[model samples]
Target: MTTIDTREAAVAGLALFPPSLRISALESKNFRDEVGLSVDAVIQLDEIGVAFRRSTLFKNIRALLSENVASAEIIDRNNQSWNIALDKEKHGIRITAAERTYLIPDFSCLHPNVDNRLAWFDAETKRHGVSDEDLRAWRRILADREIDDEEVDGLLKQFRLTPRYVSAAIEKSLRRKNIRIDALIPDEVTYFDRLVGKPAPEHDLKQFFEHTTKERPGLDLPAAFLLSSHSFGPQSIALEAVDPAKVLEFFDWAEHAGDRFTQVGVVECGLRHLHKMPQLAPHLRNIIQTIRSDDLTSETGRLELLCALIMLVDGELARTGICRERQPFWRRLAAIAHASVIERAIVAVNMLPDDFIAWCRQSRGLHFYLQTFVDMRREPRWSPDLLSASQLKAEFIGRIVAAAPENAGTMLGDGSLELFDRASSSSLVAQVSFPFSFLPGPLEGGQPSIATMPQEIEDNLNEMLRSETLTAKSFVTLVNSALLYPLDGEFARLAAEGLARAKYELPNIKSSDEAFHLLVGLAIVASVTRSAKLANEVKILMRAVRRKPDIEISQENAFRICLLAAPASAGLSDWGKYIGDCATELSFEDMSRDSITTLWNFIEVLRQLEPTLLQTTSRADAALQAAFACCPPEVKTAEAS
Candidate 1:
């Protein structure tokens, strides 16, 4: 073969050979001569992992030892034939010319490990022949020249360049000069469009994305932009035509790439290709399941990417097939930002119901999920879908009361608490189980001692006791609210003890604001349970505190004391009479609608116990009827029997 023909064939074959390995050189040319084998025949017989190697150190040194050649002028350092060697005698494969010996892989040549393998290979192959700078220099000289095949072959043999390497060098040279992929991959942007039988204007990436199909595999978008995109961010590619297995690889790169711009490109590319590629669904689902804030470098960046991915995947999953299969993915994502109990309660309440119900079904998970659900309910704005997917069954309530009733107090306002009396067939709450209590008063083992409890539980109780406005965020208030639907007397007893504790602290309370706050919580529980001792203590404390004119009582305090008339109407007549007399003096104007509703609940609960007491207390009844009389009231029954 001619020099150009031989070099081209050798390069193509070497590119296909396993890296750092080559065909075995069984014997030297002395043996070949002894066997009378021709050079062409020897070359033909070596296709089975047996062939000439890289660099200039060939097994047959006789080929380069021709008497016509002299000096290093005949040597090409860039040649590949010398790099692959048997090293059978530990001297490595060697070529001797005159007084010099060339080794198949001199210790000077670096063999790259896997991590740096590609870059090392690219560098080694491009090092001696021509630098990238020379590649640019050559491109500039050849810019206006139209070379015939003979001239091109002549240039290849002269420069010792493979056509493929020359093409790559030319692309890199142009790409460095112009920061665009078009300068790198010279194939027309309309390649896919033409293949798919569509036509579009030049370099229209959107049209390319639209017309590109798997049946017509084309150039890789990432490969084309690898060198060009360093100036801008990473380039985004619509990946409908990408192999499905590569989708995950793309995401992995996006997640772990050190450059922020590169990561941004990956997210953008994945989003652009999202719905157009169904193969990405499983990966997206897995992300939803294992969503974590710490995976990304920046929290804000993570949130931005997460929101975009969710929005894209949400559109993709609104169906009844594989889409329906990803329901846990959807439900779990409502809490993607906050997966723990405290954060979930204050931040991800929407996801609570599903987790609560599902976890409650597991024998081992019962207390963990239930405790978390109710604890979160203690936070404000925590209205949920009433455990909509599961029924409020008797056993479920029984399991709760039996399992983690201390947390049940947190479930005070939930409709499922009503189910302390009832059951259902999806899950998530309706009923007044007046005979049941979520959290019974201080544990029967005695007043809850903080010393022995878990630090978290102690923290929760202390937090509950702290009141906002002596109204909201009150442990007593929330627990008192739960007291109204006591499934047992334990809740009332608990409130009574809390009231006693407040009464002990009453005389020392420096602020009038703090003076009578605990009275409201206690009075509510007293009215629910008709506890005389709690009522007497409230009345005595209120009367004594009023004597200290600076320690005036709140209107809510008076209102709650008065609302007690319903339960105390007959048996506790003296208590009802005292509150009825105090009612007309306090104003209801500053009361919040929520507080008002709570008061009305107390009054209504009383009315159910004894409506006549409210009627007899004309002043209290008149104020309530006056305020509510102007409202467009809904027609509703009082309560269940």
Candidate 2:
């Protein structure tokens, strides 16, 4: 395979990673020594295994591995299967799945949203109001002083601009205008842009700054740093706080400040404390309806107005603090949000696509929420929308939770799956509590024989097991046969404890399929160790196994007994017969061919080690025993308890 194909394969492999791996960091040595070494063999995409390379997906996967995302999906768009999402994690251009399960890309890394920064800049300007930060930043860059990373980060926070945005502004100012990039970018009021060279009737900007900074104790601004003597103030209005009693007075002066800056400043004050003044919501809504489209479209104005609108929308609006006020404005938002199709509803409106969806994230209103989006994507959602007024409540919550990793628990009623595709190791680990269930995959290495897997992941799994934090699903995923299995004894302990705990929890799990997985998990534990306690637990699962046998799981159970108890096998002989009974009862269609072959292999091996019990009289069965001639004399079966 070419470099491109190898990288693509590596990415697909990443899809199989556990939720923790998708949102956590991994040491290079651990990944290379452990996960890296084993990944190629189990890649869901055959091409990834054939053309796989370590270097291809490592760089981009590093970032995706560390941060949270709002949405991650394998989308077939424009004739390409691309992985896209609204990334909230750190910066990067592409995402590569280490599991190689699906071909996809991370959205933010696509075309760097730079150079084209102005596309959104114009819209952002109104929402933020015109600040002299750009002009101030340009002038500061000319200072020729050394600047470091902290200062650069400060520039982003202070400007509310992306790193990309700040970088571009700095490039334009310094490379084009001989300015220093280290100079501070302003977050201050932009009352000076229109006054670059004008004669105003208000007070002198310099004197006013000095007087305001000296007299107003609470308003102790730099006053001297970014202002020029030529700059002038609007009217004689002084800056004031957003007091509930002085609300009307504030707006009065804001409108008459002789410049748009004061007007925007008033809007900012209202936004900061809008939640406290619910009575004023109606008035604010009126104000929005009256603002010019251009002003409402600017970035600052748009964001501020949206903030105010968000505060007015009813019931646990996304991002903003909750607002239960179902006002007429919500209807307007709904109308703006309406569409017959989920994607079309969001795409139908321009200007506020994301904002509209974000606001109705928890709403039950039909137009505001749709069931289709949730059905389209498999992820975690926060709530049930108990009232059922909206169909997409689950999807709504999922989008937000996917964006915020801190809120993942809201969706994990059972540790079945996360929002994205995952690799076999992570997926298997996730199902660790269920035991013999993870059987039919291509994994051939069993404990003590396998070498690949990072120490960090092993340590992490061990820690989770020791702490009893590993979920039952994760437990079963960690304890598979052959190629995919954990060497950590803590995992075994956790699996034992989990099996014990499962007896009480089984009734709570309504799905028979899920319960069967738990039963299979017990059989696996019994096969791997000599603990009487675990053996007793296996009896509990065995008595509880109400469903017809899952052949693959049964095959795995037999294979494990042969692998662990053969050659001087003692306590496992009966369990081996038990496993054999389940395995032999399976019809071809009832199990995967691979599993049938595996069962045949294990039965032959066990017959060699314990010939008296397993030897067959049937000629066909004897013929099948030919393949076991080279079976290893020693197996890793545990000492009998």
Candidate 3:
């Protein structure tokens, strides 16, 4: 036969089967690789055969091949007929059917095998041309026999199957051989090597880590770090079973390596496993060492790392049951850590249990408690279930007072008093009763000294008093500062000037809350110092309160106004009216413990100011009783004296 006739015979042979099978056969690695034909070349040949069959060209070619060769009819599983012709030497087979006729160009390459069949199914699936029948047929075939890992890996390399197919194939192979992940543990390095850079499915990686960790009992930190570096989710591993020594070793390497990504991953892993570990001291030390060794000022991420570690340690300590044993480590951390780090650490410890706070109060000195409260006031996100801001301030200040009652006045020099004033301003309704009595009392012979007052306080007071005219706010601030600091002549002088300015400004103050704060400050100053000028100013502010009777007031402010008015017989009726208004607005249903304490202090102050009023005014009596009902039993007992 001529070359044209032979080429025509090849075309007639390939068209005997369905297009899917024909495409698969041509694309098979066994066929294409042996023939040294590129996939594109095979695709081109298939397209030519398809074109030849669609036209009348293939029929003529098949007839010419048949005249020169002998043929036999074969049927496929679909019951499709195909005529097969063999050459004289039986080296080549010619296929002829009504659909088309083609030659099996080479029997050696086209021969069907398990690998080739799988490749065909994979190709069909990739092309989106595989039918349900074909899928079920291949599934049954894959299910019935065992596919070794070598063959599966070979198929994956030859034809990059989709993730779903890869997962199913791996799962099936694992089942057929009854292979456990533990069985592969010895060759894990080899397994990871083979699959790491390849398009290995996530399911395979997840399975490897899961089973390997289970079999090994502790994490292989280096291997996990490696995988995580390659974008694997390290969190998928159960880190609770990790060996602390291995974690330390990982940190040692991470510290020297200076690989930020790996360091962060290891830190996160440590955090996740911290609470689960039986002992945390070693891990805590290692983490703190890592934080200290790193220069946080060089990078923002390092600061974030410090914050994360603080959260981890603080959260662990907040678990009351576990904090006692861990207290020394936490205290050491606070002592030696950087100032910013300690500040963040203190902010996070706001949620510590009451016992922990008390222990801290007893074991730690005044400077520690003072710094903690100062740091807490600066933190915007500070919220603790155990204590509100006001309560925390009270607790800390109470500690300072108990430690050095005589030097409590010295806190004004240290800026603690100013912090107190700012805290009170921020959450006015939640104000706790500070022991102003701890401040220097009036001397029997002379005026108190202002030498210890903070420079900022002195500067602010001097600047305000020097102004041409003080606003109502300035006057109120002056009075509040006077109330918090020692009752020095300067403060009393500022208070006098503020009251003198308020005599004009109080009439124009429209907001009842604003007017009430002014009144409360003036009256408290008047009562404490027994200043006739301030007392007259308080009376004028009270009249302003009466003029704005239609103005609304919060229950807390109303109580303050009544507390201030209770001592004066001339203001007694106004005190009862204010209490009546408060009774209607007060609801202790969701009141915080600190808020309840504050309200109880108000009642106590009223009782001290005018004991008879509580019994005489029915509404005032009822309000006091309701407030007592809501007061925590300890609060009632503590303040009863």
Best by TM-score: 3
Model 1, stretches more than 4 Å misplaced?
A: 1-506, 564-582, 585-614, 621-641
Off by over 4 Å in 2: 1-449, 452-456, 459-471, 474-477, 480-482, 501-504, 507-510, 521-536, 545-611, 614-641
Per-residue lDDT over 353-383 for candidate 1, one digit per residue giving the tens place of the 0 to 100 score: 2232222233212222222111221111111
TM-score of 1: 0.21
Scored by lDDT, the top model is 3
Candidate 3 has an lDDT of 0.40
- Against the correct fold, how does model 3 do in TM-score? 0.24
Clashing pairs in model 3?
A: 10-103, 11-102, 12-101, 12-102, 13-101, 13-102, 13-103
Per-residue CA lDDT of candidate 3, range 279-326, in tens?
442433344244324443442343333333333323322222222222
Question: Candidate 3: where are CA atoms >4 Å away?
Answer: 1-387, 390-451, 454-470, 489-504, 507-512, 527-536, 549-551, 554-556, 564-641
Return the lDDT, model 3, position 485. 52
